[model samples]
Target: MPAAHHPDLELDDIQAGALAERPSPYVGKYLLLRITDRADGRELVRRLHRIATASRTSERTDDTTLTVAFSYHGLEALGVPQTSLDSFAPEFREGMAARAAVLGDVGESSPEHWEAPLGSTDVHVAIAALSPDAARLEAAAEQARRAHAELPGLEVVWRQDCYQLVTGRTSFGFRDGIGQPAVEGSGRPSTNPREPSLKAGEIILGYPDETGELPPMPMPEVLGRNGTYVVFRKLHTKVAAYRNYLRDRASNREDEELLGAKMVGRWQSGAPLVLAPDRDDPELGADPQRNNDFLYAEDARGFKCPVGAHARRANPRDSLYQDGSVDVRLHRMIRRGTSYGPMLPPGELEDDGEDRGIIFVFAGAHLKRQFEFVKTQWLNDGIFIGAPEERDPLVGPNDESSGFTIPQRPIRRKLQNLPPFVVTRGGEYLFAPGLNAMRWLSELDT
Candidate 1:
């Protein structure tokens, strides 16, 4: 397979493999730095100006390249007119042109517009090291933290969240990071041996319209585009709350192990419920060929996996694929998140207290089309599989009026009585830009 290339960015073997490693892409030691106020925006630009002009030019470090995906807040706070901000901020454009005269061989600039909610103004900054180095990452994070402190208008919402290939927990607690779409032309044999030649937009965005275009944007403009919409969520799972719920649901025959498997859709090992419904299939989970191959076809109608199973609703494998011909690729998202806080204490299983959960990060072309749509329409909405009483049993919101319930079916046995397991704490939306765009922003005037 050839390498997947955008006009401004490239996904080489290393990058693509890292991205395809798990359910989520590998974001490395990156921080979702947010700037909330206009005054902070001005101060930020001023410091960037000083750094750009005074700092001696040096070879790029594993930590040197900082890519950002700014929300409209950053742009509006910077006072970018709506007309020019989409194409290129006029001030940034001019600054780049002036810098080009002094800094020869500066890379070409390619800016793309992304969809935003009607009244959003928060800017998202995604800063990552070009290469992974612990010391450098610490320094970079410190620099970002200090920068935030210096600017009175900006407030750091979430801090020090790492991006991983797989999101830590399923509804069940197995190592659930495996099988993702291979970037087209990346020299990687598709995990699904049958589907060899997949298109870029299929996984990145939904299928194009009659003209083969994505909604709200031209195909050329969206295809190979650098910026992708990312939803960042802080989910706080009450370990005690979850454990007590499991214990209450477990009848005389069911054990703690069985109960945990049902809740997470897998066991401590990374097996799937569809394959090893009765027990943990460590061998199957380890096998690359068999792990991601099962579809919710038999499971779709609630025969094999439940209607609200995490993996089932997440991709649905072949369940939603019409005729096994039409690819429901748009539903896919690159989940690049990591687990935060510490493991739950042994005796605290019954305590109704605070505990941490996964920091959810999903990236795709359109928020409405991909991330939000999945959360609102399928995951949180139990109607996808025609089950009025089921939502994503694990992450589904708790509201009796809304008809969502967490069913506790032990291992292979079908039991309907269960309660909610996960709860939302806080979250936000962000955008991630390419390397060149970050440099351009630095040179711009406030």
Candidate 2:
């Protein structure tokens, strides 16, 4: 395929789970299912196809974006060839059960420790329902349950619901869902034009990615076209403790707010520190056009936004160019996060003992390079940023020796003994295929 000649995608057939600009103030429910008999797998796929939604249209007053995806085992149950399965990404082929410890999902979240529905041979399908309206969201979820009821060998294994914070904040209180990469042909352009455009193959399969070659995909071109991989992680945040940490480190309320902003690389209002270094600029943050326009090239000294800050490490923008222009667009991911459980009441500064965190969804064609690499290299290590052995201040695993420093005049302020605020509960890797693939699954012969 020519680099300039972009493919004409059938957006109407692709699942909306990976689409950009999904409905806001949304509620999402995840479903894990089991396929009882290979003989019934074909029928099961047909029911699932009937329930899943196509990508969103150009104009819509409202939406309940319902989507359905399947694990590698789910496809195998539907008669996909072993050769095709082997063609998938290695980490995905290994499945979440084998990759949990490497991903830091241990202790309470290890495969053995997970609920029966997760990491089990019987578990197959993964479905997601997202909607701005709670009633529509609930109805879509029920529709999936009823559809499952009609299939003989299908059983609903486990379910969990996650909702957007009313303030558009994640459990960490930073404005979420910023800095997504723009794909070559996807109508949703990049938020920052200065940032390079990523090839469609970096996200959707069957297209040319950064290597100028198509990523290895499953058998049958129709099934892989417009299809992409998705990794779901349920991360539980210890909210009150995080707030307390900030409060304890700062001298006054104003200092506390600045400290939190410095750690996150953005204010609660979503204004990046790189652009508004000294204070939180609500107007600049609220302006979608300007909020994500800045990069870290000028602030390499960590004077504006610290090099190890959460947002900088997560995307980096043009920060890595000085060392010979590191092309980071290929490593991008479409990240959609929603906080679950009850919010800690305002003005309280202690552990509330409530379960709450973000439901993290990563969409891309290259799982290892985009998702796994970012977690292990960018977020977990500081070598690339000139700070060796350091990790992200907020999300990195607690070592009791970790610290954060804000570069300022005279003496830089440094805080130590930073503890991790988020813990992994459970997660899975799935394939969100095109509509044609759904039809193909339904017709696969025993």
- Per-candidate local distance difference test: 0.49, 0.79
Q: Per-residue error at 202 for model 1, in Å? A: 4.8
Error of 1 at 132 (Å): 7.5
Poorest lDDT segment (10 consecutive residues) of candidate 2: 53-62
TM-score each candidate. 0.69, 0.94
**Candidate 1 weakest lDDT stretch, 10 residues:** 105-114
Candidate 1, 310: how far from true, in Å? 1.6
lDDT of 1 at 69: 43
After TM-score superposition, the amount by which residue 432's alpha carbon in candidate 2 deviates from its true location, in angstroms, is 0.7
Off by over 4 Å in 1: 1-9, 12-67, 84-172, 185-198, 202-211, 214-224, 252-256, 287-289, 298-301, 322-327, 346-348, 400-418, 443-446
C-alpha lDDT of candidate 1 relative to the true structure: 0.49
